[model samples]
Target: MSKGKRTVIVTGANCGLGFESTKYLLSDKIDEWHVVLACRDESKGKQAIQQIVEIDQEYASRLTFIELDLADLDSVRNFVTNFNQEKLPPLKALICNAATQAPPNISTTKQGYDIVFGVNHLGHFLLTNLLIPHFAKNDEINSIVNVTSDTHDPKNGTPVPVPTYGPVDKLIIPPQETPKRDSRYATSKLCNILFTYELKNRLDKSDEFKNHFRVNCFNPGFMPETSLARYLDPKLFNMIVEGEGKKYRKPIANSSRYLADLVNPQLDKVSNGVYYDGNEIIPSSDESYEVSKQLELWEGSKNLIKTETDFIL
Candidate 1:
C-alpha cells in the first residue's frame, strides 16, 4: 500500500453509476487516491475490479471491494467491523450510493423493515453513523454524500406522492408491508433529505466533531439501465428509456460523470446541510429542513437499530 494515498469509500460500486464513477475516479490518475469500492455483489464487484485492472494494472491495488448489503443491518455492522480491522487512514469521502427502489412486490430486509426504506434510507443512515467516528479524526476536509433524488421535491416534474407511512412513531418496522409504489419510494427519498439534515445538525452540535465533517445530499438525476431499472416492469423500463421515456431518462454514464464532478472538491465550496442537483445546491422546502421531522427520523433509526453507538453529537 502506498503510504500517501487519499482514501475514499463508495457504496454500490458494482454497477451503473457507482461502477462508472469508480472507473472514472480510478482512471483519472489522481495522485494517491485509493477508491474503496463498497458493493453488495462480491462476484460483480470482482469482475469490475478485473476490468479496471485490464485497463490499468497499476490502478488495481488502489481499488478493492468490501462486501456490503444495504438492506441488512447485521451485514452493514459486519462490514464496518471488518473495515475497521483493516485500519485504513481516515476516509476523505464517503458516498452513500448503494440503494434499491419500487419493488413490484412489497418486501422486507433481514432486519424485517420495508426493503425500500431499509436499503435506500435506514441502511445508509446506520452505515454513515457507524463510519462517522472513523472519519472524525480531524481530517482537513471530510465529506459524507447521500445520493438523494429530486423526488424529494413534490412539485417537481414528476409529482410522485410520498406516503406518511413510516416506522411507527416509536420506531418499529411493522410486520405488515405498506402496499404502494410511488408513495413508498418517494417517502423514502424524502427521508434521505431528512437524514442528511439531521446528521448535519448532530455533527454540528458535537464538540469534537463540529466543523470536522461535512454532510451533503444530491440527486444524481434519472439514469437508465441501472440496477434500479430491474425493479420497473420490463416493458415500461424499455418504453421509458428507448421509447417515449427517452426524454425522462438520461444515460447512466452521463449521470455518473455529473455526480462525480459534483463530489469533486475542486469546483465547489463545502456546504453542510445542503442539497445538490448536479452541482448547484438548490433551495428545498420548509418541510425538508423541519427540525421535528429530522428528529423523528433520527429517533426512529435509533429505535430500529436499537444500538447504543455514539454519534459524537
Candidate 2:
C-alpha cells in the first residue's frame, strides 16, 4: 500500500457512475486519493481497473477492487472484514453508488426484500453503519454521500411513479417490483434520501460523531446511458436506450463528475443534509422532509438489518 493518501470506498465502482467517479478521483486532482472499488464482480472490477490503466497506467496503482454483493447481507459483512484486513489508508469518504432496478418477475434479496430496496438502500445502509467506526474524522476526511434519483418526486414527471413510503415490511419485496419496475425504482430512490437524512440526524445527535461526520444526498439527473439498470430484462433495457429515452439521457460524465464533486475537497463547503445536482444545492421531494417517515424508515431498517445480519446499528 502506498503511504500518505486518503482512502475512500465507492460501491458498485466497476461501472457507470461509480467507474467514472473512480477515474476522476484517481486522476482529476493532486495524487491524494486511494479508491477501493466495492463491486460485486471481481472480474468486472479488475477489468474496470485496467480501463483506468488505459487512462493512465499510474491510476491502476491508486485503485483497488473488493467484492461486495449488496443483495446479500452476509456478503456485505464479508466486504467489511476484507476491507479492514487490507489495512488501507484511513477511511475518508464512502460513496454508496451501487443500485439496481429489478423487474417484479425477478426475485428479491435472499432476505425477501425488494431487490431495489435491498441493494440500493438496505445494503448501503448497513455498509455505512458498519463502516462508521472506521471513518477518519479529521479536517479533510469525512463525507458520506448516497446517490439518489429525481424520479422519487411526482413533480419531476419521469416515467417512474412516485414512491409510497410507509412501513419497512411493505417495501421489502415490494408488490409489483420496480424498473414496473419503475415504481420499485422510484421508491428505492426515495429511501436513499430518507436514509441519508436520517443518518445525518443520528450523527448530529451523537457527541462522538456530530462534528466529525457529514452525510449528504446527490442526484445525477436523468442519466440514461449508465448501467444502473443492468439487473432489468435486457430487452427492456435495450429498448429504453435505443428509443426516445436516449434523447434526454444525461451523459455519464456529467453525473459521474457531479458525484465525485460531492466528496471532493474542493466542495467541502457543501454542508450536511444538503441535496445536490452537480455543485448546486437543491430541494429534494417534499415527501423527503417528513420527520415521521424518516424515523419510521430508520427504525424499520435497523430491525430488518439486525434480523438478517445480527447487527444492532
Candidate 3:
C-alpha cells in the first residue's frame, strides 16, 4: 500500500523461486514495487514476509499477502474480487510463478482437472484472463511472466522423459499408471509456454493492449534445493538427474534475479512471447511454437475453465 508506487502480484510467493524473486524485486529502489504476495496459506505468506523484512525491515510496509489457491477455480475468482475491492495501488503486473509436480497416483484439482496440469497451467490461465481487464489501470507496459521449464524439450537432453501432448480432453485426465510423473510434469510446463504465446497473440490484436502488455515464458532451470525436487520418489529422482545434479542446474538466487529483471518497471523494454532460459533469451521446444497446438491448448483450456469461472474475454 505504498503511495505513488505500482503493484505486482507474485503467486506462490511464500517459498522457493517465488519468495526469492519477490526479494529481488523489492530490492529495486528505482521502481519501488509494492508487491502482493499471492499465497495459498496465510501463515506461510507471513513467514516469507518476515524473512524478507529480516533482510530489510523497510519491506514490511510494501508487502501484502493475499490468499490464492490456484488448485481451485473458485478461489481464483474470489482472489480477484477481493483484490479489486481492497484499496491498493494499481496492479501493474502478474507473475504466475506457482507450480506443483505430479503425484504417484492420479489426482485432480478442486475443479476436476488433473492436479499437475491444473495448478501449473489451468489455474494460471483463469487467473490471467480474469486479471487482464484490471491490467489496463496502468498506461505503461505491464508484464505477465509464466514460469515454465527447460525439461519440456527432449532436445535439451534432460534425463527425464520429454513432454507428450495429446488431445485436450485426455490432457486433463490424469493417467492411472505410475512412472509417468516426469512426463506429466514436463507436459504441464509445455502447456505454460503454449499458453504464454497464445495469450500474447490475443492481446496483440487489441489496441487496448497493443503495446501495453508483455507476456513471456521463463524457465528457472534445475534447482536441486527446492521442494519441487524433494517431493519426487528418490528412485525417480535419481533416474531424472542421471546421477548428475549439476546438469541444467542453476542456483536459486541467479534464477530468481533473472525472473525479477523480466518485469522490472524501470526497464521498459518490450519483450512479448519471448522465452528465457535462466538469464538468456533462447529458442523453446518445437512443440511450443506450433500455432495449431498453441490455439488448441488455448481454446481447450478456456472451454474448461470458463464453465467454472468468469473470464474477461
lDDT, candidate 1, 249-273, per-residue tens: 6566766776665445443465778
Ranking of candidates on lDDT, top first: 3, 2, 1
The per-prediction tally of clashing pairs is: 1, 5, 0
Instruction: After superposing candidate 3 on the true structure, give the runs of residues whose Cα lies further than 4 Å from its correct spot.
Output: 1-4, 177-181, 235-242
What lDDT would candidate 2 get against the real structure?
0.81
User: What is candidate 2's lDDT per residue for 1-313, written digit by digit as tens?
Assistant: 3532778899999888898889888865553688999998999999998989897766666787899999998898899999999888888889999888664465688777777789989999888988898888777748899998888887877665678776788888555423343576788889899888889888888887878877899888767667666566788767867774655467778778778777775565777898886667989999999989888988898888775444423
lDDT of 3 by residue, 14-110 (tens): 9899999999999888888888999899999999999999998788888988899998989999999988986677788899999988765548889
TM-score comparison, 1 vs 2, better candidate: 2
| Cα lDDT for residue 5, candidate 3 | 78
lDDT of each: 0.73, 0.81, 0.85
Best by TM-score: 3
Of the candidates numbered 1 and 2, which has the greater lDDT value? 2
Question: Considering only N, C-alpha and C atoms within 3 Å, which residue pairs clash in candidate 2?
Answer: 113-173, 114-173, 178-181, 178-184, 179-182
